[model samples]
Target: MNKNQPTRPDGTRDFSPEVMAKRNYILQTIRAVYQRYGFLPLETPAMENLDVLTGKYGDEGDQLIFKILNSGDFLKDLPADAVTSMGSKKMASKIAGKALRYDLTVPFARYVVMNRGTLTFPFKRYQIQPVWRGDRPQKGRYREFYQCDADVVGTDSLLCEAEIILMINEVLGKLGVQNFQVKINHRQILNGIAEAIGAMDKFSDICVGIDKLDKIGLDKVMQELADRGVSGESIAQLKPILAFEGNLQEKLTYLTTLFENSPNGQKGLADMRAITQMLNSFAQAKDFPTDLHIDFDLTLARGLSYYTGAIFEVKVEGVQVGSISGGGRYDDLTGAFGVPDLPGVGFSFGIDRLYDALEELNLFPAEATVATQILMIGFDEASFAYCLPYLYELRQAGFATELYPTVEKKIKKPMSYANNRGIPFAVLAGSDEMQVGEFSVKNMLSGEQQRVKAGELKTFFATK
Candidate 1:
């Protein structure tokens, strides 16, 4: 092994059994809920053609794509100018023509485009897979991690947004999340605000600042907006939206006045009204994890250039990890794939962040720590012979039981192995105990051993 190889690459990890148990629990729950919504499972290759991925996620995102270099004598015919631009834009295409996919959506678009002649419309699929990015590793951002995603393509129905939110509520609710909140915003609404404030042409720049409102806070965000060439009158018209509050409708009332002459603003307000109503009809606080709320804030702009419709972010209470799940509608997401007007909306459940949340809440059951239900003990040579059948019986009865492989080790030695593995129960078949048609069952947790008959072994573990 290379000395440089570490336990995990930077921005990556190796989950222990304890962590994997909790993580798998979260994933299984998400899978069940996603299937309930009728999303079929789909998976794409871990890597995709560089042309398929480049320019899809913006310049920064393109940089984050983990490009695979040309293999076997890669530099033999490289152009001098191409060699000069190593690690720059031109060289990326010449030397690295493919990349580890940054997200599932782009690849899905490419797949649909390539297979357009043979597929059905409104394809709904769920993909749970590892995606890679070159992002700086931190507490919640990992370069490689599984994103449990579900998306529906070929429809622009607001009903889909409602359903997506409903799915989010169901997944988190089943995962024992009760204090998190889902922050909802529309790209149209954000654009509307820019138009109303006479900064329509500067919508992109305005969005960059507003999206940072939470990260840098209001004061710094305002300074950033001013630096972007926003005028005092425009800023004044934007202030009320930046500070709007009350119920969903009240927020819309204020927006109506602010965007009185802006037609696009009118459409955005109408879309928000319909989406909020749809969400309310299905997602009730009594049934959902976090109470759903919609507010008018110029600062909720999602940073993606592709999000042309509704967008959202989720935060769980008492958890320090950033948005555990987030996504939005992309009307022309498949446009680059030559399938324009195929609107799609979806969300990604960041399994790692949710793992952190579950950890913070201590929601996993106590029994989740064990990798096996029973550990067969090595009492003596005769005991090992007598215990083999019992081990098979335990295995057949749906308990994961393992026998100690080496007969050379003393009983204490193997027992220590069981303890180290967190195996809770142990079966001992000593010579005397074997002849009596009963075995000693040890509760490793309590160190209490009891004589249990062979016939009753399965029954004994039923409750556990």
Candidate 2:
């Protein structure tokens, strides 16, 4: 490693101003939708106690958690034999007591438990923040990424699920994501399938394989099940359920019949039916734009162990990228912390993946990249000093304005700076314009120039 040469760690990145502008655009758009739905803003620390995060995301997610070593002689208390003989995983547990948060949901659950006395029930909150995962980085996958989450806790009403779906539709529409579908499922349905196959002990094992269905197809999923010691008989019984096909109603009817022997399955089917019916009713009542679509994907088993009912995953149309957003209902997520029976349902927009999908589809608006609206150029020291007041005035008038730093800088440099920064208009005030009390405004886009008195500068730009 060349110490002098700057480099970010692997699976991480630095966002330049342009990139940050686009990111902010995405964040603000989602934030607007979240606020419109009555979700107040929330924030939690980047790190949480290891226990709070460990069992929530299932085995794979636990392995991805970036553990933070206990500070100040982490290994001080370990026995010499243990320190010398333990493997990396065992050693890590001995030395690490905290970890970078894996996701917002767990931390939110912890927060609710700690602050339950102050907060009202059914608290709705939106959190936009980065999470760390020690996973291999690839396309649409990152070790560090922001999850835009909105969750409503303490309510079991399917209306919460319906409203979340509507918010998802409105948010994607506003972001110009034209093609996408919200795939809905229930955890109870998966449980019912496990019970039906008499593999209740292998529920997690089965879900682990089934969750990969979309990524690795049916054949591979079957082979994986076999490798995991799932009997051929169970696979045979489970295969048709995985391959079940039909419209939402038809699929539900089929599942109702298939899971008829399993009460969990029947309950899950009824829950799914209720939520979809609520969604249909909402669609009928509101004039929703025609861009959004919802589908009942029986195969969608969000791998997280906490999700209990009404799970959701969003896939962009015509894009091979993975789901852009996903979440589900969690009952008693706070129960482990002694705050039992609090039900919450929410979804997270995988901001990075969403950005990549939007970029691939050319969905970002052109204005999202423009940083400065006006750049003021000064030909000489005296003229540059003269332009400062106008720069201040323009900013006061609610325009994104900038002044050339030094009058000693050449005119070409200032023009180039403005051009490079995508400033749409340039205010050119030199000795002549300073004396005349007028400024020449150059339209960066059209190459049109016009003279305007100082008093009319704001009005001129305002009209444009």
Candidate 3:
């Protein structure tokens, strides 16, 4: 092995058996929730055209993107002068035209645009896949991680947003997360600040600054905004909203007055009002958790500039990390791909952070291990062969079955292996049982033993 190559980067982790079982259960439950709402599964390649990703996420997101190196001596045509002068971006453009996808949303937009003819309208998809980034890894932040996303394309209905909000609520409930709040904002509301203060030209810069609100606090956010050329008047306009402390209604009334002149801002406020109305309807029907409330801080700017409408961020009360899941509506993501007007709204559950939240909250279910249900203990050479049919029969009956493949390890070794693996059942087949048309069914958990007819092996596990 090459020592210099090393194993994995910081901020990333490998999931062992027990951890993965818990993660898998979380994913499966979320997937079930997505499907019940008629969302279909979709997948895109892990890498995509560099141009497809670059400008979509603004500057900081571009910095986080992991660019893949070109293969097969493709960089042989390197111009020495350009190489020296242009550095990474210029050189990369010539040699590397593709990159590992930074997030599922962009690639999904590309997919929808390319396959628009083949798919139906209101395309709903759930993608659970790993994404690569080059960001500095810290606790709950990985260089590579999975995103479980559900999105609806081709419409901008407020009901879609409502359904997704409830969907998020349902999955979190099922995952056993009790104390959490879904903080929501709209990009248009964010845009309102820029519009209100005439900093609309530097919208991206404003967003990048404000996205750090949770991380840097209000004074730093305002300082960052000012540093980015936002006028003093603009910063002051943001003060009351950022400092506003009240329920959603109180904040909304203040925000409406503040953004009264801005058409886009008022539209965002209307959308929020409609969403609140929908939430009230759900509450009347008893479908939502009472604690799920919107916090409308002017500072809640999601970093992505493509978010054209309602944006979401989920967080727990006492945790110090970033948002566990976030997303929003993008009206022109498809337009970038030449498929105009295909609006899409979606949310991504940050697998790494969500895991951290559950771990911190001590909400993970009692671990169900990956142990085999039956370990066919091979007493001798013929015993394994004899138990092979019984193993196959038991497996066909839906039990996870494995065989102790080596005889050099004695009965004690296999039993110890079963114990280490948390295996509950062992089919102890000896020459005597083979001849007698029976096998000893050992229950590793209860330490009970019983004889089972060969034909009844399948029935035993089936009923079990």
Best by lDDT: 2
Q: List the residue pairs that clash in candidate 2.
A: none
- Could you arrange the candidates by lDDT from highest to lowest? 2, 3, 1
Candidate 1, residues 223-312, lDDT tens digits: the string is 878888888778777766787667767778878887788888788888888987876676554645346433344467877478888887
lDDT of 2 by residue, 1-464 (tens): 78799877779988898789889999999999999999999999999988888877768888999999899998788888885689777887878989999989889999999999999978999999999999999876778888999999989988888888888898888898877899888899999999998888888889889999988999999999999989899999999888878998898888777787999998898888788777667667557565348888878898747788889999998876789999899887788788788988988998888888888898889888877899998898888888888898899999999998887555888898888878889999988898889999999999999899988899998998
What value does the lDDT take at residue 382 in candidate 3? Answer: 82
Candidate 1 colliding pairs: none
Give TM-scores for every candidate, taking all chains together and pairing residue i with residue i: 0.93, 0.92, 0.88
Q: Which window of ten consecutive residues has the lowest lDDT sum in model 1?
A: 287-296
lDDT of 2 at 456: 88
- RMSD of candidates 1 onward, in order: 2.6, 2.4, 3.0
Superior by lDDT: candidate 2 or candidate 3: 2
- What lDDT does the true structure give each of the candidates? 0.82, 0.87, 0.83
